[model samples]
Target: MNEYQKFREQIDEFMQHHPQSPLDEAHRLYFRGLFYYEPSPAYLVMATVTRFSAREPLVEMETSTGDRRRYRRWGRAHFTIDGEAAALTIYANPYEEDFFLPFRDATSGKETYGAGRYLDSHRPGLRQLGEGEIGIDFNWCYNPYCAYNEGYSCPLPPRENWLAIPIRAGEKVFHSSSR
Candidate 1:
């Protein structure tokens, strides 16, 4: 199996049996596994980051539980899909040195999580920075913990990060008959 599929397997194992899983005991029994789009090379990208200056201000992110969380505007990622231009602002957690990328594509509320998906330090694929480019593999994008269980409050993608195009990759909406 490929690395992406292996990653999915690890996630499945965690969600199914880990005590700290977002899924409660009752829900775990009904969860076969998370659904994912077949890995697609098209979504893999090396985006050039435009670092923010001191002039850039911090932004507040709205969460699923209606709470506001603040993050510093770190930089902007500029890349393309099939030669079509696209850009997303990258945020940095005020208390931590990790990057945060919350986004909603055309697939949201349909093929994927209604609130949005996330790509950040919590996952492995996009953590390292190389020069001015950051490797972003949409295949690593995942639904926030809230998607599996409402008990978890996850940050929603900002309006600027909402993509007009569909990104048919990574994790799809979870399905559980028990819900």
Candidate 2:
């Protein structure tokens, strides 16, 4: 199989037993407004991430939940968007064994949500990708459950993940959250 195909297979395998698979649930479509530095057409990216690491093999990690969940590490990754190549860095929580992407692009406090947003990379199968070189796709970027719920202490994005450019992707800022 090709690289993307391989990646898809890994993602599918991960969702099978992941804590937030949403399996058997009805599909819900939410509209997210993404803005680019300049006026550029928006592209459709999967907008997700998977976990990876040798010490912690399962993409899943322990969280506030009684059971464990999945997460992705922030490492080195390469992507080509609209034929332009970009490199990114991600972060990992050793204690929680969670991988998260907390980023603040030019959109901070502007077109998109401010205080940065996050993506959960908790796919066990895809976790392997991060174990090595550790570069990943920003397409899966998402908002922590805290964006919608008030009882969770989702890890906030670190200052290092903040990018100077406009991400124009993923979930928007939760206007109600103190973050």
Q: Which stretches of candidate 1 lie over 4 Å from their true place?
A: none
Candidate topping lDDT: 1
Name model 2 segments beyond 4 Å from true.
Answer: 1-74, 78-88, 95-97, 123-135, 149-151, 173-179
Best by TM-score: 1
Report the poorest 10 consecutive residues by lDDT, candidate 2.
27-36
Tens-digit lDDT string for candidate 2 (1-179): 65434554454454344456433222112212222222222523222233235454434433333345544454544445555555444556556646555566776677655545655557321243423444344444555554444456555454445566566654445443122
| TM-scores of all predicted structures | 0.93, 0.45
lDDT of each: 0.86, 0.46
Q: Write the per-residue lDDT of candidate 1 for residues 69-91, one digit (tens) a residue.
A: 88998888998976789999888
RMSD list, candidates in order: 1.9, 10.1
